[model samples]
Target: MIKLTEINKIYRTNEIETVALENVNLEVEKGEFLSIMGPSGCGKSTLLNIIGLLDAPTSGIIEIGGTRTDGMKDKQLAAFRNKKLGFVFQSFHLINSLNVLDNVELPLLYRKVSAKERRHLAEEVLAKVGLSHRMRHMPTQLSGGQCQRVAIARAIIGNPEIILADEPTGNLDSKMGAEVMELLHQLNKEDGRTIVMVTHNEEQAKQTSRTVRFFDGRQVE
Candidate 1:
């Protein structure tokens, strides 16, 4: 479903350049749950961002769902991202003022869908995450777990084929983290969603279908 060949990401300043990823090649099959593990500043999140199309690679080929995304303009990339990718962040980037349902419905607002249908889709995904009861509550009113659940709902509401989770369980307590992990598993296994997650927890990484370790911006075999 996703393939990267000879991908490299470099960040440059006036005098120094840092390598965030080096000659990285990876392929994730459809419905596979792949975990990326690395120490801080080792390019785990950078790799995820590149694969998610949030950032473009310096020079490489990125094929997602059989389409090459390398040379697309910004507008085309945005449309492709909306239709093919969903993102879950470590910070659970939800709007503080919007209710759970409204936040989940935000992704659909850009589409040619009606308000009523958006509401229905939002509620459906929230229900999938077992958060239908909190639909009207604001982000401030919810716990960390609830916030992430809301984030997950917002992500999958568009029914994107790939889910990119960057340190998804980083902020929650153990139990809540477990809950979110289980929810992700259900999405991958039952719903046939392709999941690529970056995580520090060894046990959580173990639970995934495969785990790839990184060091100093290179994949370590």
Candidate 2:
């Protein structure tokens, strides 16, 4: 479902250049739950951002769900992301003033859905993530786990084809992390959504369909 060829991401300052991903090549097939395991500064998150179209690689080709994204214009990229990609970050990234329902419905606002339809879809996904009761509460009103669940609700509300999670469990306790992982597993195994996760936890990586390790910006395994 996703393919990257000779991907390289480099950052430049006035007099220095740093490479984040060097000659990185990878793929994730449809219906696969892939975990990226890497130490700090290994380009795992960089790779994920490129795949999700949140960032462009310095050079390389990226094809996601059969669409080439290397040269997509900004407007086209936004539309593509709205239709196909969902993101879950370690931080909840919710708008504190928006409340749960509005936060979840934010993604749909970019589309042409009516207000009623947007609310209905948001409610359904919030319920799916076990947050229906907290829909009216603000982000500050929820616990970390609840906030992440709300974030998950927001991510999936658009019915995205691919979910990219970066350290999804990094900030939660083991029990809460397990809960999130179980939810993600259901999305992958039951809903048949493709998942590519960047995680530092070995056990968590082991639970995925496959694990690919990275170090020094290179895939070592």
Candidate 3:
């Protein structure tokens, strides 16, 4: 469902250049749960950002669900990203001022969805994530695991084809992390949502269907 060819990403300054990804080639089939494992500074998160359309590669081609995204304009990319991709970050990036339901509804609001429809869809997604009862709770009132579940609810509210999770379990305890991973696994297996997760935990990586390791900005066997 996703393909990357000879992808290269570089950060530059007037005097120095650093490569974050080098000639990276990858393919993630539909409904596959894949883990990217790497030590610090190995470009795993960079790769995830590129795949999620949050950032562009310095050079390469990226195709997602049969659409080529390499040359899409900013507006087009933003629209495509909203329609095709979802993201979960290491930190539960929820708006503290918004309750669980409103946070989950934020994406739909940006799409110009009407209030009634947005509330309906947001509640459905919250129910799917088992957070229906926590809808009125603020982020600070939830446990780490519950907060992460709320984040997942936000991610999937749009019904995107792919979900990109960067260190999704990084902030949780082992049990909580496992719970989050299980949720992601269920999404992949039962709902057919393609997931590409970046993780440093070997055991967590093993829980996925496939694992890709990275070293020094390149995929390693």
RMSD of 3: 1.3
TM-score for each candidate, following the candidate numbering: 0.97, 0.96, 0.96
Index of the highest-lDDT prediction: 1
RMSD of each: 1.2, 1.2, 1.3
Residue-wise lDDT of candidate 3 within 61-98, one digit each (tens)? 99999999977899999999999888999999999999
Candidate 3's TM-score: 0.96
lDDT, model 3, position 88 = 95
Q: What is the lDDT of residue 106 in candidate 3?
A: 90
Which digits, one per residue and each the tens of the lDDT, describe model 2 over residues 1-221? 99998999998998899899999888889988888888888888888999999999999999999889977899999999989999999998999989899999999998999999999999899989998889899999888889999999999999998999999999999989988998998889889999999888989778755545654586635
- The residue pairs that clash in candidate 1, if any, are none
Residue pairs in collision within model 2: none
